[model samples]
Target: MKNKFSEESIDFIKDHINDDPAEIMLQSRKFPELPMRDIVVQIASRQKAKNKLPEWFGNYELILPPKQNLEQASSEITAKFKARFVEGDSLVDLTGGTGVDTCYLSRKMGSTVYVEPSEELCAVSKHNFEVLGANIEVQNSTAEEILNHNLVQSDWIFIDPSRRDNAENRVYALEDCVPNVIVLEERLLNSAKNVLIKASPMLDIKKTLQQFSSCYKVQIVAVDNEVRELLLYLRKDNDEEADIEAWNISDKREEELFSFKYSYEESCGFDIEEPQKYLYEPNAALMKAGAYKLIASKFGIQKLHPNTHLYTSDELIESFPGKKLVIKEVLSPAKKEIKKRVKNGTANVIVRNFPMGANEIKKKIGLKDGGEEFMIFCETEAVGLRAIWCERV
Candidate 1:
């Protein structure tokens, strides 16, 4: 239902919920309507731990993300969406959660309308927008409701349809989902020239494209080494002629491909040459593009080895967004070799393309975690090798 809690109460509840949500969860169930009461109720409802501040905060842990999970509606999405925003056009972000994307567009667009359904979220967005001094209109309504309330003939419309995290949940296309992105695209684009939709990177990207028209571009964003988000760009014409381009984005650089994974892979067997003194690793995005050979040739760098995804040169190349590893010393993964390489008792350790765990490998060499030196136990295209005293290359 609509919100009954005041703006301050909602903020406090949400903050407590997200931060130490266990508390709020138990507290909320006790007093369902009162946000403050609900906090303690929800927390107590679950289970109680005899705890205090510092230790409670220390309860945080790490969880490995699935490959390409949440790749949609992340920093990459905001950056790319912001890149498209210009000075005069009006922009609308229909599902304005946290208003991250809306804040981005408001910076460049002449005007922006952020339509968020929940009053709590609307309050939050309004507060943030004010702090940023952004010229954005905040509406407490959903995308469907906003269409009825305002004549928002925006130049751009962004819709990030939520995907159930369960990969096997079985949503096949826009027509099958809630708010049906494909159907929504048709309606929104009728008024706006461009519409951007963010979808699960885990979903069958190809199937989604097949169900939608006027899709001009698709972007896969990889953070650090993990692929986290995906975005689809569509146009108003329902034009079948619009090019379907795939872009891979990483902090290093962005690479675009005309085709997709299967076709690109089938086209060629990678050709690898010996790595020069300077080695370039492809950024996360270009790697996702799967246009291995195309990007290598287009960028004018030689691949390190056929199986290896590294490029190298005698000359320093700053253009390639990947790490530049300067290979100083290489040794075997055996205890004797490792000890010899790190004989001076200084090295960092990394296990890559190796069956052994990092701790096992480090223990084998009597190497500890913190030091100025770096050690990487990785299998490169050239073959298996252990590197010590190597920096980010």
Candidate 2:
């Protein structure tokens, strides 16, 4: 909320508004209390144009910036929350963002009080609740503010903090954070008997369980084989261990494989190789969770290279968590090798973790936009390979 930004920085942001308008929009909406000029400068400093917002920003069109990672809040997190809380009980959401979590709790909880710091989001949440016809009350204040206001009584208090870049922020163990277990035990825990905490998946699950054993359930969620959300569910005075389990969800297609499509399971096992000319990389959530080898081995797909998570096979596989490819031809780096293939000049290009981006690849390959055919260029642990998509095979 400070005004450390300068006028020069403000002008720079305005100049790029036509191209980087999304950045100005996202930050401005998230921190609405700040002046427009100051917000532009802050966005410039934080992002520095190194990364533009995701093209798939449509998901957040009606929601606010989440303190927790929004992209990670797939069904994995939603399902877990529903399973933990019963209906007709009061729960306090300490850090509500976009109010999506609250939306899921709609059918289960009797009443919910959201504690948020962003004034911008408070107004938005009101609109969302009205639109969805929800009766939950939201307080546009921080957890500390609400606590100071003597508003800490609840059956369950939930927390989903921000820790994408800052590890220290995620270090709130048993005794830290808003109304820690110790504080809860003295006050609300006896009355309400529930406290749910969400932390980053990067945290040590064993350590978290050992320190917070009083709570009965500790849930770790991984969407599409990638760890997205870590949930700790507690009931007052309850003592037990959560049955640790793992699951993968795919909205597109689901399938199982017995062996590697090319390399036998007994032959390659879980080993990875270098990048190949033609490679297939899974979707984002999968990549983030480091389930690269698991997917490859599970689907009987071989990696083009170990360094790259891209997969390759002679036949197409259904039900994998990525695009099915029909690799037509492998192009050599030599312009001459590509010249003959370029004669047709009609196909889409699929680039998987390639040095050159999708546009760069398309430009270099002389392919037109929205073509029926596709070419895959990718690297892996062992080597790089190239191929054309035959079909979803």
Candidate 3:
């Protein structure tokens, strides 16, 4: 990557940094000497980074990748969370696309090597690393090439496989991902004492663990209640059942963490009862980890139904790992009953183990989307389907 854009182009980008990209493109004819298209890309990418990558957005010298790569790159919040696992003297990033993970991990290690097959991405990452003052070596080669040639050895290795196929379709299976960690598991373990793999949140955790011989831990990470990534941690000779951890990074920058042994959830027993005074719904991370029974047992709350994940308690459990709502009333799902109980024609609707979807129920009940109250629809063992009105605690 030679300096394709000149100093004038840089000044132009800085001058119109906050301008609309589409508007900038329409005014391209006025600025004939500047690289308007490239400048517009940088401006647009910077706008997208405003919230996701605040640190990078603050630094004008950093060269961000294209919109697609930026979208695939981990947010700064998640990158910082993943960096806590970094250990030892040296680290190797096997698939360093935009180098966001590598840049954060590099701060914790004595030395770091970033490997990516794309020459363009490698160049851009190398430039960004220099601008950010990160001590990293950029390798323009594939992970397989580096491992096969025995190019480098390190204490820890991290890889986030490409989740897209040649046709640009998204894939969720571990075997379907590029570099196919399933095939390279043995070699990766042989090269490093610990291997960390970032996977799609949609991947089945149990099936993914069965594909690996050394996986010892699995992390389901969510940001602001939305499940984001699934991490598989592998040790050289570990054979224990993988420990499962669910992390919900709240908007307040606090972590709502719950961890359990993979086998414990299957053996746990829970009590089934009707809706009580309060209702609890597990966060996205816990739901993705399949902790339905374990959560009820751990929290000492009764479940509404065997299949329904909603829980209830007579006493308020402030330490529950999810939303806590106080039940105002339990009424039939009939429109007339709901209308009589709920004077306001608006509520936040949530459905669990119910026949109709949330939108369908909302339409049937003639309710709008937003309000101070929540209408939770679920089935209990005693009463088949009931609508529980609640307010956030």
Top candidate by lDDT: 3
| Over 4 Å off, model 1 | 1-88, 127-133, 145-152, 164-178, 200-213, 221-228, 238-270, 274-276, 343-389
Off by over 4 Å in 2: 1-88, 97-100, 117-132, 147-156, 160-280, 314-316, 342-346, 352-355, 380-393
Task: Report how far residue 23 has shifted in candidate 3, in Å.
Answer: 3.3
Tell me each candidate's TM-score. Answer: 0.63, 0.51, 0.96
Q: Candidate 3 lDDT, tens digit per residue, 82-193?
A: 9997778999999999899999999999999999999999998988998889999999999999888887778999999998889989887878889899889888988898
Q: Native-vs-model 3 lDDT?
A: 0.89
TM-score of 1: 0.63
Better candidate by lDDT, 1 or 3: 3
Top candidate, metric TM-score: 3
The sequence of per-residue lDDT tens digits that candidate 2 reaches over residues 269-313 is 454543323345565434443455667767777766656666766
Tens digit per residue, CA lDDT, model 1, 1-393: 122335555455435543565554555566555655434432331122212122222221211111222123346244544456334478888887656567676677888989877676677567656655778898887787666555678888878765542464645355555457665665777768888876665655556667665776677655555656567778866655333344444445554233444454556554565545765656565565556676566556776545556666677766655556676665666788667766675676655456688888777668887655566665555654545335564
TM-score ranking, high to low: 3, 1, 2
Model 3: lDDT of residue 116: 98
Backbone N/Cα/C clashes per model: 31, 48, 0
Worst 10-residue stretch by lDDT in candidate 1? 59-68
